[model samples]
Target: MTADRDTLPLPPLAPDMQAVMDRLMAEDGVQPDPTLLPPAEGRAKAEAANRRWNGPAPAMARELIVETPGGRRAFVFIPPSDTGREAILYIHGGGWAFCSAATHEGAARRLALATGAPVITFDYRLAPEHPYPAGLDDCLSLWAEREHILSGRRWSVSGDSAGANLALALMIRLKNRDLPHCGLLFYGVFDADFESPSYRQVADGPGLTRGKMQRYWDFYAPEERRSSDPCLTPARASDEVLAALPPLYLNAAEVDPLRSDSEALAARLHALGRKDPFDTVPGVVHGFMQMSIWLPQAEAAFDRAGEAFRTMT
Candidate 1:
């Protein structure tokens, strides 16, 4: 089935961004389907696409394997002017089923350069093959073994899309574990609700849509489990739990189906008398952070993320 492109409520993409969206549309990206193509193939395709959009890789980044309990691969980016005090553990977004650490290494490298700190991105397990607690558990294992990754260093967790979801959930999971983590969430999927205002307004997207996200949720945690698990649905968190979270820096795409996810998170935090800063990158959709090579707004968003890392840590 093809969408009526003429009438879709598409985001007002920037001049440069129009090209990227055009490519997706040409490739029939209306709905996401990582299941049809194996994850390795999907990741290779994404890495190729990202390389074209990402222009050049940051000079000081390398890929390494981390033997978490789950045994995932990771990309580590080092800044030219690095201090050993702070680091970022970035997770890439692919609806929790696609993309990889290599696919998002460009953005991570930009962040490392901007923050003057090392940024480590993990290739965590995905869903429908590994499923819900699997991906989250892989992240948690890394946190449990953070001493091996970086001992005595202040590190913050950050991710885009589903990666952001993991970052937020890990903050909650490790809240009482005496870990030093502040969260940098970029257009996260914080709730199971599919009827939020942004979901309605930007539902049938030029990028992400209501139906596509539902598919992702179904793959991550079947409907029966999503509602009852606050880890999967962060918005369902109680005021006390929300209050206990580390200082968070929430960034959202102004014209994104998941925009309200960030708003929902902001509201929950405010209800607990916490004042976390939320910034919406204008004229872009979800996944803008990875398009920094061509999109100025993406670069600007990374600048904000770097500043957030500096402020939070």
Candidate 2:
């Protein structure tokens, strides 16, 4: 599989970021798999990573505690310089296993910088401990209850990896109830199928592996619950809904196993006669967004995603 940088020559990174990259490359030890725990523990790991954050050059970030219908959620708030700008509802990906408002700090800040839109990344419930629908329910429930807080402005929803699935799924859930998002930006999304081209091709891709993905699904959706909902497996969704869906833009990394899901989804949208946008970022691996320390390409992709989103808003 090709890397993201091979397909996209990203922008130059800052000096501190370059130093961080150098230090990481100088190390000789094997990199431990980072996605190795449940949400709470993984999120704890993120806070530790926060200490190393050099901060994005263009934007500022702060965490907000949003009171959802079910309970409190940690929302990382990145206000655009323009307060009157559009708002972004973002979801972080860890297959609903390990991800937090802290983990996405730099990424959210960069997003705000590029889009000039207020970005809010939420900490939705995770699975196994909570199980199927519990986490998904928390995210969807947000849509029903958050409009009043937006001050009558239109909005967009976006997320990466499993979080991307959530964006697509949550929108479907919303559309079922006749609610609409101005647009959707989905990146590196995973589908429920056990077999796909990338799954077989990049079965052992760095940052993410096949066995680990299966483990996440095992934790996210138990057997009885896997049968019907397309949210967990958006590819399994019907064409009728795909056609009715709002404008969407999907980004797929060539070296990631989940690339197939994005490709398959693009195909489905085309077959349904939809005009959703799609792009394939090559020369990068899965989870590169978090690899900003060692991978310049990852940071660039994040920037590109942010810039592209600004226009849609």
Candidate 3:
């Protein structure tokens, strides 16, 4: 089925989420499908669309940028009254092609408040220009210098969608070294399998669609390397790597095509006798957490993730 928003049958979204979606749809009515646009144009449109939900960001005690390798940027969001040594490294999701630290500023601020600790986000290289190991390398560069930049704080990793994929991949890359204290993944894209149950069920979306995701994969990883590269498709990581990951807090939107990815990861962890928390938020679509300013469920999800982080730290 085509991913036509008007004709696709979708599960009901929460009232607030429905209202937010309606407003976004109206605003985007004149624009072509971003997924089909040129990378630069698509990035611009995605950034502009996210600005609405970011609404007067939650106050931050401080904000700053640190330059990483390749002259890429990393942004730090520090909440008021934060005194702990714990922090979060938040990675923004945009199918590995669109969005940036600026588009995700509000969500990072909210995360800082939710966890009562500083939150850091960065601008990784986008695909179809840099592709594959480039973005992951940028993330790794920042991680290597986290101590100097974060002032020796104990930090966990957190991300949404493709960002979550990278976060998990980072963990796999560090499986034999120092891992993050915990992980908070939201509706992450964990695997490349387009035939998964959720993929077929939500092939066309009120939000994320299977076709869009396929394009994202094509841009991010060459077909020859997709299945073999654990960093590209993290779910394919070995059982030893999976079992060695730190504590995790995962959630999936009920109507998201990526929902099953989280489910599969959680199941793998369970089989390893790990009791990590996995929440499935009903009545929402992928990237709903970006609407935390307008959706209570979004805020609540952050709160829950914060709680999970605290327990592990």
Give the winner by TM-score: 3
lDDT of 1 by residue, 193-297 (tens): 777777876887656778879878877888998877778888888777788888889989977889988898898888788878899877788788887766788
Off by over 4 Å in 3: 1-10, 68-72
Report clash pairs, candidate 1: none
Instruction: Tell me the lDDT of model 2 at 206.
Output: 47
* Full candidate order by TM-score, most accurate first: 3, 1, 2
lDDT of 2: 0.66
Error of 1 at 194 (Å): 1.2
TM-score of 1: 0.88
Candidate 2 regions with alpha-carbon error over 4 angstroms: 1-28, 31-58, 61-71, 74-85, 176-180, 223-227
Cα miss at 26, model 1 (Å)? 7.3
lDDT of each: 0.77, 0.66, 0.85
lDDT of 2 by residue, 1-313 (tens): 3453244333243454445545655753454454565556655664565335435434464445566555655364555464565777777777777766667766666666666666776677776577667777877777666654455656777787888888887888776564445554545554666467777766775446777788788878875555467777777788887776777778777767787888988899888887677877665556556666556766676677766665555
Q: Estimate each model's TM-score.
A: 0.88, 0.80, 0.93
- In order of lDDT, best first, we have 3, 1, 2
